[model samples]
Target: MQEKAVVYINSDDSGRGFLGAGGSQALETFVDEIAQNVIDPQANVSVFDRAKAHELVDASSAKAKKEILERKGSRLEALGSGSDFSSFLQHLGIPTLNVGYGGEDGGGEYHSIYDSYDDYVRFKDPGFKYGVTLAQTTGHAVLRMADADLLPFDFRSLYKTLDKYAKEVSELAEKMRENTEMDNQLIKSNDYAIAADPTKHEQLPVAKAEVPKLDFSALKTALDSLKKSADKLALSWTAASATDADKDKLNKLLFHAEQQLLSAEGLPRRPWYRHTIYAPGFYTGYGVKTLPGIREAIEQRNFTEAQQQIGVVAGSIMQLATYLAKPL
Candidate 1:
């Protein structure tokens, strides 16, 4: 094992206890807190830190790159070199910390000459101030993670994501209905806007078009029920952490909670992916689909199907809520 370096864990973990048990109030609190307090980019932006590292060898000579490389006793570059900490941290699910300093050096040196030490010292860590900053940030992370009483995962973020997806699916259903209604009226009226105002008028499309009204009452009721369940679970879990009865209830609900969110038939087009919280949209690759059943149903202009899907999603939500409401 290489020398261990320290790192900070700044993530919020309010949802761990509720992971399988369903939605917990703690998870909601986590999301709320994050939205309220944003992390500073200079201080917390890990992605930027990673990107800045490449400057360590930019526009410089091989001599400089090699010098820094040798001094640091680290490779200037490693192909297929899975960074030591990444593979295990990311793949094995072990938390990881990647530490490095660079960015002042604009010295670029591809596998060629022109790469020399002449440029690195003058450019890369000019005063090495940022290097110190990096160290401080790293130390902060290590201390936070090591000292925390619990894992740092945020449940509120998860809930926010879910809420946004639900609204999106509902909106899709509305839009599809409107378009279909417009198409029907277009054929019935035989009045193309072109014919009505052939002079290229820019007034705007006519209004008062009636689209199918989706019955979200079922969904609302389901959510309300689930919220109640979540509250119940929080009360029970908080009051009796050591009770087997509470744990048993939570464990039983865990299986039902997440499972209830999935449709045996899967999304309308993509049957391979399941799971309500995380799924690939049929049209959007690499993008997540939330409340997909209803969303996809609307996209396909299937009102009856869309309406049915709302019930399905809502039922899942309620199931999860009930699970969370359990004693544990």
Candidate 2:
């Protein structure tokens, strides 16, 4: 089996966008590099085209050109469980890509008998334009992977994305604390009873304990270290002096980087799904829960568990940084 790259083209007719795909760290970068370079023939533009336009439009006139020039190629969604790429990415730690096209086609015939070829042709892509487009897009991606001298894996992007998730989890904890405090205060003051009319019966909210402060120092420190290490790795990889053996060793390390983010014990009550950074929400099912271990624990108001998970996730981040910092 080829260790270079893996691409999966899944049907996406939800009208959200062209396609939303993701994978483990190395795979995520591999797919994104291909998507950014491959031009969308139908639109007569690169897949990165719209993102550039959006950035330019959002920026001030003076900075617009600069923003467009510096902007990275195609955006990638975080990979959650519940897709064909799950086993290849989450289990085997292979570089995998799940691709598809959508955003102009919308329908409600999913999983029904009406979801036939005729229905698709009539309601989805008439004349099969999108089908051909998807073929072209994924085909180009496959060719690029097959031909590239070094596997394209962007550790910088991964570090930035993970850093964002860490911030989000910290913010989530603070927000939960604030909300809990507000609720407790409202109950203590009997505001609910005061707001109710004498003629109508009302049940007052029960008084609850205030949420305790969470320690995010460890997580923050780990994320900072990870970012520095990632920056160094990215620089080293892009250097002209780097050799093929160096690239190969770096790629191998990246391939297993995502594994460090997984815990043997898994998220609370969800042992089968082991990704700490991204996982399918237990209640939302298909929806993604970033920093799942910490986010879900806080969501359920399990402060003790949340604190424990925070340390666990911090350790994982530190481990990943160590791997990247190791000499190639």
Candidate 3:
């Protein structure tokens, strides 16, 4: 049997901008390095980051999102337990990335009667260039992970990414509040006359209760601590040198850092899954929920549960921050 390299990341477009692709910013860069080495600089590429990374969600600003895509890449999409990497990532809390390459191919050729190696070789990726690109990208990542003394798990990148989630959820709550108020105004003014269908008799929609003012102070505090610790570690990362033991210790710590994110009582009812930061949505199956506890609760309009989940997420973040603050 021919030896093959383990490909952890898939580098492709989902492709309007980078919507379906999922991975870390660091790993994205790692994969991009491989692609840059092989693929032409001028090669036509498509990306997807336009979507809010959800099924019910749509891109907020196409022009602004595309600007981000043109500059660096997509907003690092979260991992869903839909792939082979789920166990290593969502369950065990290991770092993961998804990368793939494609953009030349257009619509019509999907998973149907026409998806074959012959057609792929002739039409999609002529000369199997993408196949080479994929090989190089995955091989290099594996090689680096295997050979490096210090593991490439950058917690600062993690902090920044997570901070965005914190901000996003806060904003989501506020947005929901505003929407609810507007709808309730319409409901009150029209006496709940709005029905699904104007012609047939349909149940009238009720005025939604206001999205309560959620106290995210605990979460905010935890994130503040996490940022400081992450910043400190990043500085250590840049220091002149360190003993092999220290580097090894730091690597081990980084490796196990994900464990700190596991809520002892995982995700409301699904105790099997841990790792609080990322999880598949209760409703959106394969679509991931960042800050799942808080995000899902708010989405479901369970203000009480949302408040409790906020505490859970805060505790998890504090656990991670405390772990990161450890001496090298």
Candidate 4:
């Protein structure tokens, strides 16, 4: 029996290669590393490296090219809720992988009664070569997971991704402040009435409250502390003297680390979905809400709720950092 396991999933009905959702950074890195390393057999190059080279040639602008080239690997888009991995990752906090191949298929008959073998072979994966590719790619992932002495849970990438999300929410608040100020100014000046045609009677728009300044310093400080702790943990795990017991302890820590991101109270209205970092948007269905508690509060113009959520998220990060900082 395998000491650890890697589940390989292929959402045949799903369109395109690896439409990942939930803990996307971790899963994307996992899949991308495997895809990039496994030779395409026919193409004679790693799938990821080939894709990267093509992107460089097809890039339209110097800035775009630079950004593409600077990227360490293929960009893994954030997961929303359209696949089977949602339950395992978001609900159970399991480190799972969702894999598939697409981009060549037109998906003309997707989810329809007419979607059959003829449709698949005719439009999607004409030679069934991509099907083989998917198996080989995921096979490599399973082998790596099963055979490796230590699991590959890259906290550095996770920290980097989370840091990016933090900056985005902070900037979102700042941008809202500016927009609200401008709207208030226009309302005060009766700009709408002034701009209205003389023939038509246009009602003045109601004024909204001034956007309050949000304090994200706590969140920022917590993130910094977490990054430092992640770096230290990475070093300790990779150290030459790390024993089997030490590795086992580290693995357990890694498993529970993601669970710490969950809030006991959950989001403002949604208690079932507990992940503080990622959740499906309340209104957008499948759309992802990064830092949902804070992002949604700000989006709805609820500063009080936003402030409360900030503290909650910050506390979670601090707790995780403290756990990671514990001596091995």
Measured by TM-score, the strongest candidate is 4
Ranking by TM-score, best first? 4, 2, 3, 1
- RMSD to the true structure for each prediction, in A, is 15.0, 3.8, 5.7, 3.3
Q: What is the C-alpha lDDT of each candidate?
A: 0.46, 0.70, 0.68, 0.72
Q: Residue 323 deviation, candidate 2, in Å? A: 0.5
Q: Candidate 2: global Cα-lDDT?
A: 0.70
TM-score, prediction 1 = 0.48
Leading candidate by lDDT? 4
TM-score of each: 0.48, 0.85, 0.79, 0.87
lDDT winner, 1 or 4: 4
Order of candidate numbers by lDDT, starting with the best: 4, 2, 3, 1
Q: Model 2: residues >4 Å from true position, as ranges? A: 1-17, 25-32, 51-70, 197-200, 240-247
- The residue-by-residue lDDT of candidate 3 on 1-328, one tens digit each, is 0012222454443222222346643344444444344433223432222122232244367775465546553345688766776766666666667765443336576777787767766666666655555565567667777776776655666777888899999999999999999888978887557445677777776887888899999999998998898888877766613544457667667667777888778888777677788888888878888989889899889999999999999999899899988987
Q: Per-residue alpha-carbon lDDT of model 1 for 155-266, expressed as tens digits?
A: 2333444566677777776676677688668756765654666576645445443557889887777666765665565555455544434244443443234444555665
- Tens-digit lDDT track of model 4 for 21-128: 224454556666687776654467777766676678778999999999888756555555776666655565555565555545465666798888887776665677
| Candidate 4 lDDT score at position 72 | 77
Quote the RMSD, in angstroms, for model 2: 3.8
lDDT of 3 at 302: 94
